[model samples]
Target: MIPTKEEWIKVLNEKHGEDVQKKLSAATVAICGLGGLGSNIAVSLTRAGIGKLILIDFDRVDISNLQRQQYRMDQIGEYKTSALSENLTLINPYTELCVHTVRVTEDNMEELLREADIVCEAFDKAEAKAMLTNYVLENMPDKYLVAGSGMAGFDSANLVKTRRVTKRFYLCGDGVSDVNDNIGLVSSRVMLCAAHEAHAIIRIIAGKYEI
Candidate 1:
């Protein structure tokens, strides 16, 4: 049986101190692109008890996504925003979710992410990644952005590290590997990068910003 909301919050308070839990529980995060990286990042943040999540994606789950994404085989044709929200609700019923089944473009980016304290960029294409990164850095100056760079292939897991790009911009991944280089993405490595993004956001929420 699912735990009561009070019971769940108490557990999170024990794991994270009361002050930290309060901050985490008050933060809103927006995840752009619900693919391997975004899916895993959302799971981590939800499990950490984030208060609200804005999930944006324009794609449907495909059979190929099962290798690294968080969707189930039964959800293959479902829109990623819908599927991920369903899964996250099952994981943490207390977390509020606002999903948009539309692509995030230059025009709608700011409005969609306006309420988020942190924004995570997890798009698959290089152009898309650059587009979101540039838009966030240029337009949304106050929001913290955590982006994935090079999590493709089976490289040393240690290579997947998080770096603080600017005061509010951070990046996770190896900075070298690419899927177009003939090396495909491995589940473990991609998830590792996702974890970095998630952890960075948690640390930011908890007021720990060293790495």
Candidate 2:
């Protein structure tokens, strides 16, 4: 098993600088949806040396998703969780990851939270986020949950902001909206929100950034 702190930083410092290695190697994050936003978040976190990662996504890759998601055309039809988990392990062999290829629901919320130190909500559906948030607020008040909103267009840069949606939950995405119902996202907007989600997780772990 990889040591959560010292050993991780000692090896990771060669890839990330000292501060990033220290901050990220101490953190465990869940990228709950391996879609456009979740893909970016997981990639950045692995690169940053986040100690443990949890990937939860029931969806399969589609050609449409490849335009914004980090996965390649060859990965189509693969489960998002499995592909992302596989890639993350390849990126950093020492970093631990759990892959859950099931949708998050009130029924399995407890099961999902059991292994994670904090949760990240990358679901695109409003109902899923609401259910996940409600479950956390009612049953797991101590855990952290970070989320995103308004990231689907070229103007997504203007939308990425970090703010507390609740006491222990954070919202990271465009505060403003340019994502129409039919709008599509570029890699930039999706990745911007994703990076903010990774940063929030790292900050929470380092006792610096608060939800």
Candidate 3:
């Protein structure tokens, strides 16, 4: 059975301390893509008791996504925004979710992410990643951006590290590997990068930014 909201919050408080838990529960995070990295990052944040999430994605789950994404075989063909929201709700019922089954573009990004304290960029394409990163850094300077760079291939897991790019911009991954290199993405390594993004957001919420 699922625990009561109070019971869940109490456990989080015990683990995170009251102040940190409060901050985590009050923050809103926007995940720009709902694929491997975004889905895993969303799961981590939901499990950490984040208050709200704005899930944006324009793709449907495919059989190929089963290798690294969080979608189930039964969820194949479903829009990623919908599928991920369903999964995240199961992990933490108390976390509020606002999903958009649309692609994130410069025109809509500002309005979609206006309420988010942190924005995570998890697009699969380099062009898309650069677009979101440039838009957020130039337009949404106040919000923290955690982006994934190079989590593809069978590279050393230790190579996946998070770095603070600017005061509000942070990046995670090896900074070298790419799927186009034909190495492909491994589940464990991709999740490691996702974990870094999630942990960075949590640390930011806890008021610790010296990464």
lDDT of 1 by residue, 78-196 (tens): 99999999999999999999999898999999789999999999999999999999999999888999999999998899999999989999999999899999999999999999999
Give the per-residue lDDT digits (tens) of candidate 2, residues 96-143.
Answer: 788888888888878877767788888887667678877887798778
Ranking under lDDT, best-scoring first? 1, 3, 2
lDDT value, residue 80 of candidate 2: 86
Residue 94 shift from truth in candidate 2, angstroms: 1.2
Q: What are the RMSDs of all candidates, in order?
A: 0.7, 3.5, 0.7
Q: Which stretches of candidate 3 lie over 4 Å from their true place?
A: none
Candidate numbers sorted by TM-score from highest down: 1, 3, 2
Per-model lDDT: 0.95, 0.78, 0.93
State the weakest 10-residue window (summed lDDT) of model 3: 101-110
Question: On lDDT, who's better, 2 or 3?
Answer: 3
Comparing 2 and 3 on TM-score, the stronger one: 3
